[model samples]
Target: MSSLKKDVCNPYFSHIYIEKDVLKHPVTKKILSLFPNAQSLVINHYKDIFCRKNQNFSLQKQTPGLILARKHDNLVYEGAPVCQNFGNQHFYYTSSVMNCIYDCEYCYLKGMYPSANIVIFVNLEEIFKEVKGILARHPVYLCVSYDTDLLALEQVLGYTKEWIRFTAEHRDLTIEIRTKSANKKVLDEVRPDKNVVFAWTLSPEKITVDFEKHTPAFEERLSCIQAAVKKGFQVRLCFDPLIYCRDWKEQYRNMFQRVFSCIRADEIKDVSLGVFRIPQDYLKRMRKQAPASAVLQFPYENDKGVYHYHKDLTEEMISFSYELVRKKLPMEKIFLWEKTKEEK
Candidate 1:
């Protein structure tokens, strides 16, 4: 039996509550020890922390810890990117966990939060109920694992597994778990649901190695996606925030070829393309955090509060990449996320 199947039997975590009851399980106690100063926030069925604002790189690198907070059952949009993309359609997203384990330099988390502590919202059932209510009105697409990679922390939190079970029961609901984790253990334990899409944000090998610090290698991520496809999971490809690199076209062409070669076209559900863009405030914070990073120093055009590549260059990249990917995937299966004029 896997360690996950074994009942959480630990004593140090006796003060932690799952729903309302304080859990004395040994494993839970061990996990709690990682954050000794955290306060238990119990809001309705969910319990987590109300973390302090400005948790950017400077604060997190000093004392990396976890925050415990309960998410309000009524609220859905948890983090940044709140107004863009699906936010317009009233599509809901809830983060049971906050602060990712990986340390990608391009990640907005560096600018968004002042700390690196992982915040876990314990009241999951209430969130599920809220989701059910939302889905009753119209077919909903929910993006899970956005703020954090749920699969990487699956052994510690089991929230991803619970989500799998929840989405499996609700066919009207579409759940997308976007991740960079290469953990295959979590995938093996849970069967795939047709309504759930396991989306992986992929980059070129050079970019993955150089820019995405501490993340899984490009090949490893591809292998994980391949495994998920074999398990009957609907997989989506995201070549988002395409980094501008030397020999950029060749790099992207090789990446697309490598991706299609590993996974069949029929197994893929869809592909989303978006060039790198960040809010002005976040970019300022990120620049302060890493003064030497070329990614931060690159000349960017500020459209409103967000910063992105120049319009002409960004559009060209998007068009070229989308065209290349479309050759491998059907037109209906391709989704392009670019900034429109009104968005500027």
Candidate 2:
């Protein structure tokens, strides 16, 4: 077992009654220390904590920490499209957990939420119940993880594993776990379910090296995805927030070519493409955090409250990426996020 697994065996986790006891776990302890005065609510599971109306800013700033535990009331439904949800498939995304492990400069979590702490909702049963309710209605396309990368913390949480098992039983519900993690230990323990699609967000090596601090290298992510494909996992590729850089065309083309060389085209389920964009308010917060970043410095056009690359450039990048990915994946497998006319 991994060191992360061993940490769970600690005595502090025995009493899940009081919120304070939940924080007694060394992982939770380290996180709670950041917010000494913040109250803890120990519920039956992770999904119980409601987002306090005004708490978004404060929560987004802390180094990721645990939040309230409760089961999800509903699952298997579509979410409004924001900066992250792509493919325009009317995605139904459930947050088995909140916050992320990686700290990318462009991440909206930095601007949208006030805290940087990770909130792990331990209530899997509730989410499952909600999902069951949805599956009863229609064939649901679910995004298992949008707020956090369950795969990255798989050993510690076991939520993704549970989700995989759940999806395996429900063939009518299509699930996607989007992640940037290179961790494949979970793959060793669980077989890939046909209904569970393993989607990875890929970027050029340069972008990973510069902007995506602490994230796995591009090659490492590709290697992990290839390993999953070999195990019969339905794998999908996402080249989103395509950062603008000098020689971006050459960089992206090479990246695409390299990906195809490593993973067979037939193994890939589909590709989703989107240019970099963020809510305007989030951009301001990110800029405050890191003023020196070229990503933060770029003059973005604002559509409503969201900021993005100028209309023409955003379209060009999206179009170019769509064509490039189409070279390896079929058109039906390629989904491009079109910018709204107002966004132009």
Candidate 3:
């Protein structure tokens, strides 16, 4: 059952949905070449097929369709407040893809989008040009994988490799590709660049099994991080959206012990920690989309516009993580929401 689960768990892109206009484009052709067996469906626009009503996100994830489309406008967006800017003056994020392959119970994408399918913008060069123009004025920090996990889809998409080359040319440009994937081979393919940070999102094994569905387990994610770091990549570990599970303190404490034991503390760029949070409206929509989800059903406190663990729980989680991280890594290397309570 476990072996079979591994084979069936990963989302398979069995159908290719291509925008009619990009049918002749080289990227579309190359992507189609990768999946020659996938049935091709031509459409006028991606959202037309991707944003359809009554589509089951979970069901579609089993046999997901790939949408190759052209992004018309808003090539880049200012980074959201919820995300850590890492002290960048001009931070931005671009969604070359719409959705993720893995199905995490607490993921906001389920609420933010109407489809379970993955959308890849074939026009990668255009987004780069937009960044180049933005760079003409100021140094820019971009999070390219905010909307989707680029590492997980690297085999077919290879957008991260393209971004690596793009960053190589633009000295002023810095990008962060965040993922929960532990695909070691994909991580090794790209040349590690300080300008391009590979941030791994890590969770305790218990939370991983319960909240993060279809994801690489905690140990796998740690090994992936060690491999990247050994390969000379600036690795950032994110304990973000910290889950409040059974014996939460002990869970996180043991997880941290296992984490620093295998990976060198001094080599890590930084560690980010935060309690569970979702846009108030997104959580509302997620509850509607996944009514059975206990993670979303938790009665959270609304602070301004976002829904999150109440102040007390929020502080406890972040403070506990901060203390644990500081013990092994430098205090400066610790990054979090900066709860009112500080740990020494």
Clashes of 3: 0
Which ranges in model 2 have alpha carbons more than 4 Å from their true place?
Answer: 1-63, 71-77, 83-90, 340-344
Question: CA shift at 22, candidate 3, in angstroms?
Answer: 0.8
Q: How does candidate 2 fare on TM-score? A: 0.80
lDDT, each prediction: 0.73, 0.72, 0.86
Across 1-344, the per-residue lDDT of candidate 2 in tens digits comes to 01234343322222222244354455455544544565555654433333434344332332334564433445444675563454434458887666787767787777766555456654467678887887787777888878778888776677778888888898887888889999888888888777888889999999999878778999899889988998898898988878998889999999988998998779888887888888888898778766677988899989888788888888788778777778778787776665532343
Q: Against the true structure, what is each candidate's TM-score?
A: 0.82, 0.80, 0.93
Global lDDT of model 3: 0.86
Candidate 2: C-alpha lDDT: 0.72
RMSD to the true structure for each prediction, in A, is 7.0, 6.9, 3.0
Model 3 lDDT per residue over 36-148, tens place: 78889999999898989888776676667899999988999998888888878899999999999888889999878888899999999999999999999999999999989
Which residue pairs clash within candidate 3? none
Q: How well does candidate 3 match the true structure, expressed as C-alpha RMSD?
A: 3.0
Q: Tell me the RMSD of model 2 versus the true structure.
A: 6.9
Candidate 1 minimal-lDDT segment of 10 residues? 1-10
